[model samples]
Target chain A: MPQVNMTVNGKPASGDVEGRTLLVEFLRETLDLTGTHVGCDTSQCGACVVHVDGKAVKACTMFAAEADGAEVLTIEGVAAPDGTLDPVQEAFHQHHGLQCGFCTPGMVMSAKALLAENPTPTEAEVRDYLEGNICRCTGYHNIVKAIMAASGQDVSKIAAE
Target chain B: MYAFDIERPTTLADAVKLLAASDENQALGGGQTLIPTLKQRLAMPEVLVSLTAIDEIKGISEDDEGRLCIGAATTHAEVAAGAGKYPALAALAGNIGDPAVRNRGTIGGSLANNDPSACYPAAALGSGAIIVTNTREIAADDYFEGMFATVLDEGEIITEVKFPVPEKAAYMKFEQPASRFALVGAFVAKYADGVRVAVTGASEEGVFRWSEAEAALGSNFSPDAIERLSLSGDGMISDLHGSGEYRAHLVGVMTKRAVAAAG
Candidate 1:
C-alpha cells in the first residue's frame, strides 16, 4: 500500500491506499467524506466531480496517488466555515435545482467550477458547461437556471416556470 | 482494477529511464482513457509510469519557426485555454469528451492511444504536425500506424508535438450523443503550399487523410470542388450508431463543412 498525503477541504489528510484505489474511493472510504457520489463506474457520469488544485476533475478517473501533495476540494468543502452554502448551492436551493438529490452535489461542484472560470456565462454557456453533469430527475431546466442565478442574473421567469 | 506499482518521475530523462527498466510498463497521462480501461480490467501492467510530474514535457509555447509546441503532458484544458494562437486546435481541444475529461486528458496520451474517434489525431495529421519524442521527431504521417496504434517503440516516450501554423483551419465533428466520441470528425488545414484533410471515426484503419478530397480542395478550396468526389464505404466503420455507408456520407459532408468553416 502507498501512503498518500493531500490537503482535503483545506485540511491535511493522509491515507494508506493501494495503487489501484481511485481518488473518489479514498475520499469517501478513507476520509469518510461521502458527499462526493459515484453514479457510474465508467466515468461517463459526473457524480464524482471534485476540484483538485482549483480545477474541477472527475475523481473516479484518477488514482488516489495522483492527488498526492495536491489541494482537493470536495462537495463537503463547498460551504463556508460559518455554515453558509456556496452561492451555487444557495441558488440551487432557491431555484429548486434538484429533484431526488442524487446529482446535486456533483452538479453544484461542476456549477461552481464553471462560474469560477466564467462568472457571467450566458444561458447557452451554462448548458454547454453542464454537458458532463447529467441530471435525470429535473430535466436540467432548473439546474441551468440556478447556475445563471448564481452568476447574479435574474432568472425569475425561468424559476417561476 | 489490477494492482500495479506506480512511479512518478519529475524529469523526462528519469521517466524514460524508469520506462526502460520495466518490461511491462504503461505511461500514464491525465488517465482519462487509461483509467477507464484499468477500471474495466482491460489492461494490466507491472508498473505504471506517470508522466504528469515531469516538468519538461508540460507546457505550450511557439518555437522559433512560429510552430505551436505543446508538451506531452499538457492537458486538454490547458491547450484549450492556451492554444488560442491556433484557434482550430484550441477549439478541437475545448470540445473533447466534456469539461472534466478535457481537464484530465492530454494530447500525448490521445495521440499515443490513437483511438479511431480521438480528435487530436485528426488535428495533428491534418495540420502535418511533427511528433517529438524522447528519441527523435516523427512526421505525423508516420506517427500514426493504425487504430489504437502508433509508431512509438517500447519505452519510447513522446516529449512534445510541434504543429506548423496554418493560414486557415477548422475541425467539425458529429458526435455520438451519449459517449461524446466522434461519430464522424473532419479536420481541414490550408497552408500556402497545400491543403490537408484528415478524417477520424469514419475509417476502420484509423485516422487517415482523404488525399483525393485534399487534392480537389487544394486547387479550388470550395465545397463545389468535392461535390463530384465521393468516399467509398469499403473501409468506413459501421457500428450501432450508423452504418458504413452513412459514415462515408458524413465524411463527405464534414469535409465540405470543414472547408467552408476554415475560412
Candidate 2:
C-alpha cells in the first residue's frame, strides 16, 4: 500500500491506500467526504468529477496515489470556509438545478471547473461541458439555467427562448 | 480492483527500465482508460509504470519542419489548448469524452489503445502523423494495426507524436450519446501533396483511410468529389446502435461534411 498525501478542501489529507484505490474511494471511504458520488463505474458518468490541481477530472479514473501531493477540491470544498455557498452552488439552489440530488455535487464541481476555465460559456458550451455529468432527473433544463446564472446571465429570459 | 505495485519514474529511461524489468507490467497514462479497465478486472498487471512523473513527454510544440509535435503524456486538454495551428485535431481533442476525460486522457493512450470509436487515431492517421515510440518512429499507416492494437513493442513507450500541418483539415463526428465515442467519425486533411480521409468507429479493423474518397478528393477538394464514393459494408461494424449499412452511410456523410468544413 502506498501512503498518499494531498491537500483536500484546503487541508492536508493522507491515507494508506491500495494501488487500485480510486481518488473517489479515498475521498468517500477514507476521508468521509461523501458529497462526491459514484453514479457509474465505467467513467462515463461524471458523478465522481472534482478539481485536481484546479482542473476538472473524474475522481474514479485516477488512483489516489496518482494524485499524491496535489491540491483537490470537491463539492464539499467549493464554498467558502465560512459555510457561504459558492456562486455556482447558490445558482443551483436558486434555479432548482437538481431533483435527485445525486449528481448535484459532481455537477457543481464540474460546473465550477468549467467556469474557471471559461468564465462566460455559451449555452451550447455549457451543455457540452456537462456531457460527462449525467442527471437522470431535471432533464438538464434547470441545470443549464443554474450554470448560466452562475456565469451572471439572466435566467428570466432563459425560458422565453 | 487487483492489487498492483505503482511505480512513478521521473525519467523516460527509468520508465523503460522498469517496464523491461517486469514480466507483467503496464504503462499508465492519463488513466481514463487504464484505471477503468483495472476496476473492471479486465487487466490485472503486476506493476504499473506511471508516465505522469516524466515531464519530458508533456508539451505541444512545432518542429523545424513546421510539424506539430505532441508529447505522448500531454493531456487532451493541453492538446486542445496548444494545437492552435491544427484546428481539426484541436477540435477532435476538445470534444473527446467531455471535459473530464479530456483533462486526463492522453493522445498517446488514445492512439495506443486504438479504440475503434476513439477520435485521436482518426486525427493522427488523417493528418499523416508520425507515432514516435522509445525505440522508433512509426508512420500512422503502419502504427495502427487493428482494434486495440499498435506496432509498439512490449517495453516501448510512446514519447511523442509528430504531425504535418495540412493546408486544410476538419473532423466531423457523429457521437454515441451515452459514451461520447464516435458512432462514425471522419477526419479530412488536404495537403499540397494530396488529401487524406480517415474513418473511425464504423470499422471492425479499427481506424482506416478512405483511399477511394481520398483519390476522388485529391483532384477536386470538394464534397461532390467523393459524394458518389460510398464505402461498401464489408467490414463495417454492426451493433445495437447502428447497422453496418447505416454506419457505412454515415462514413460517407461524415466525409462530405468534413470536406465542406475543412478550412
Candidate 3:
C-alpha cells in the first residue's frame, strides 16, 4: 500500500492506498466522498471530474498514488461551510440544469473549473469544453445556460447572500 | 483491475533498472490509455513503473540545430498549449479527443501504444520525427511495426521524440462521433526534399504513408494533387465506425483538407 498525504477540500488528509486504487476510488470508497461518480472506466466520460491542483481532471483516469502530493477539490468542496449552494450550483437548480443528476456532479465540476479559468466563455467554447462530460439526460442546452448565468454572477455576492 | 505493484521512479536510470527487473513490468506515462486497459482487463502487468516523477522525462526543449525535443512524459495539454516551440503541433494536440484527455494523455504513451485511431503517429510519420529510446534513436519509418506494435524491447522506454522543423505541415481528422478518435486522419508535410503524407485510422496495419498522394504532391503541394490520387482499401481497417472503403474515401478527403490547411 502507498501512503498518500495531500490536501483535500482545503484540509490536510492522509491515507494508505493499494497500487491499483484510482483517485476516484480513493475519494469515493476510502474517503467516502461519493459525490464523484465513475460512469465509464474509460477516460471518455467526465463523470469523475475533480480539481487536482486547481485543474479539472477525470479522477478515474488517474492513480491515487499519482495525486499523492496534489491538492484536490471535489463538488462537495464548492458549497459554503453552512451547506448553502455555490453560485454555479444555484444556477443549475434555478435553470433546471439537471434531469437524472447522475452526471450533475461532474457537469458542475467541469463548469466550475471552466468559469474559474474563463469567467465568460462563448457558447461554442462551453460546448467544446463540456464535450468530455457526457449527459444522457437534459441534452446540455439548459446546462450551458446555467453556466452562462453562473459566470455573470459575482462569487462575492453569492457568498454574501 | 488486477492487483499489481506500482513503482514511481524519480530518475531515468532508476526507471530503467525497475523495468529491467521484470519483463512483466509496464512503464506508465500519463495512464490515460494504460489505466483504461487495466480496468477493462485487456492488459495485465505484474508491475507498473510510473515515469511521472522523473523530471528528466518531462518538458520540451530545442537542440542547437532547432530540432524540437519533446520528453516522452510530456502531456498532450502541454503540447497543445505550445509548451514546445511548435504551434502547428500544438494545434494538432488541441484537436485531440477533448481537453480532459489532452491533460492526461502523453505523446510517448500514444506513440508507444500506436492505437490505429490515434492522432500522434500521423504527425510523427508526417514530420519525420525520431523516437529516442533508452537503447537507440529509431527513425519514424522503422519504429512503428504494426497495430499496438513497435520496435521497442521489453525493458526499453522511449525517452523523447525529436521532430525536425518542417517547412509547412497540417493535420486533418474526421473524428469518430462517439469516441472522438479519428475515423480517418491525414497529416501532410511539405519539406525541402518532398512532401510526406501519412494516414491513420484507416490502415489495418496501423498508420501508413500514401505513396501516390506523396508522389503527386511532391511536385506541387496542393489539394488538386490529392484529388488525382486514389487510396486503395485493400488493407484498410473496417469497423462499426466506418468500412474500409469509406475510410479509404475519407483518407482522400482528409488529405485534401490537410494539404489545403498546410498551405
- Which of the numbered candidates is closest to the native, going by highest TM-score? 1
Q: Write the per-residue lDDT of candidate 2 for residues B160-195, one digit (tens) a residue.
A: 999999999999999987677999999999999999
Q: Predictions ranked by TM-score, top down?
A: 1, 2, 3
Candidate 2 clashing pairs, residues 3+ apart or interchain: none
**Considering every candidate listed, which one attains the maximal DockQ?**
2
The better candidate by lDDT, 1 or 2, is 1
Q: For candidate 1, lDDT tens digit of each residue in A1-161? A: 87999999999999998888899999999999999999996778799999999988999999889899999999999999999998999999988999899888889989999999999999889999988998889989988999999999988776444
For each candidate in turn, the TM-score is 0.99, 0.98, 0.95
Q: List the RMSD of every prediction in angstroms.
A: 0.9, 1.2, 3.4
The clash numbers for all candidates, in the given order, read 0, 0, 0
| Cα displacement (Å) at residue B140, model 2 | 0.8
Q: Candidate 3's error at B171, in angstroms?
A: 0.6
User: Cα lDDT of model 2 overall?
Assistant: 0.91
DockQ-derived CAPRI band for the predicted complex in model 1: high
Q: For candidate 1 chain A, which ten residues in a row score worst on lDDT? A: A152-161
Docking class of 2: high
Instruction: Report the C-alpha lDDT of model 1 over B183-253, residue by residue, as the tens digit.
Output: 99999999999999999999999999999999998899998899988888988899899999999999999
Report the lDDT tens digits of candidate 3 across residue range B1-263: 99998899889999999999988999998888889889989888988999888889788999988989999999898887764466668788888877777777899999999998899999899888999988899999998898889899998999999988788888999999998889999999888999999889999899988889999999888999768677778889998887889999999999999989988
